[model samples]
Target: MDAFSNVDSNNRGKRIIDGYTPEPYHMPWIGLLVKDGKARCTAFLVSKNANAKASVWVLSAKHCFNDVLFDEYEDKTINSTSYGLLFGVHDLRFSTQHVIYRTIDELFIYPDEGLKTKDIILIKLDRQIKFNSYINGLCLPDSTEEHTPYEDTPW
Candidate 1:
């Protein structure tokens, strides 16, 4: 049996704070980072090549790959080949034609930042990901707006 087959999909009260199940395709930028075929962490598409309709970059929390976080593992660094991204799905347990998988090509964590600081990471895909109704990217804020507060920013 597949390791992922045992994944439990039931989540009656596991919403994010006050979040609820969003309509399909409403949050197409969300994705799952799969480590050795198992869901390891959540990520989001932050960039895309408009001309190619393909996403090239994704963002996730840095702790997802930190060695200290996985005390049971002996490896200090994660192997890129062992990871992939699963996109275009609201549910992770089910395999649908709409779900697209892409291998990870590279990982970029912010320099000089520890697990407790910044806590962000950016990933590059092995190949550009073609976008669809269920797969797309969210716009990253421009550098000029980096210091702007988001408390009043409209989503």
Candidate 2:
């Protein structure tokens, strides 16, 4: 049997909050530090493999790459590595061991009109990662609905 066979099928409430550690395979919660010298925001370092190949892509918000001015500049030049995702962050200092996945190609942004959500950014990894690690893949939502509403809400 496959390890993912019995994995959680529900996508809505399947979010996992992991403890920060020095482990390499562990998924570290990340934040973006602006280039003009600003603070960071709440973000997470996610990995995904759209293709079955060994290559993995890191996902984050496009705005996390730089300020909104770059969006108006028409020039696609932006600083990607300016922000660092500190692993095992307890009190701001880099406490736990963390691996900073380098950005291979230009960031890919998902274009959508009506949605106010942040644009999804993709950063390709230099090499392929193992099947099992702290950076595990997550299951996306399918066509099925499995969530229930509160008792007071109308069915």
Predicted candidate 2 versus true structure: per-residue lDDT over 1-155, tens digit per residue: 12122222232232235522333433333422223223333334453433332334455556565444545635443454453332223333223333233323345566654236756666554445333333344333355957656211000
Any residue pairs clashing in model 1, and if so which?
A: none
Query: What is the clash count for each candidate, in the order shown?
Result: 0, 2
Give the per-residue lDDT digits (tens) of candidate 1, residues 1-155: 23234334443234355555566667888888766565677888876335447777889888878653443433323466567777877765566777777777777767645677888888888788778888888776667865766321001
- Segments in model 2 whose C-alpha atoms lie over 4 Å from true places: 1-39, 42-55, 66-77, 84-91, 112-115, 126-133, 145-155
Worst lDDT run of 10 residues, candidate 1, spans: 146-155
RMSD of 2: 12.2
Against the hidden true structure, what lDDT does model 1 obtain? Answer: 0.67
All-Cα superposition RMSD per candidate: 5.2, 12.2
Best by lDDT: 1
TM-score of candidate 1 versus the correct structure, residues matched by position: 0.73
Cα deviation at 26, candidate 2, in Å, is 8.1
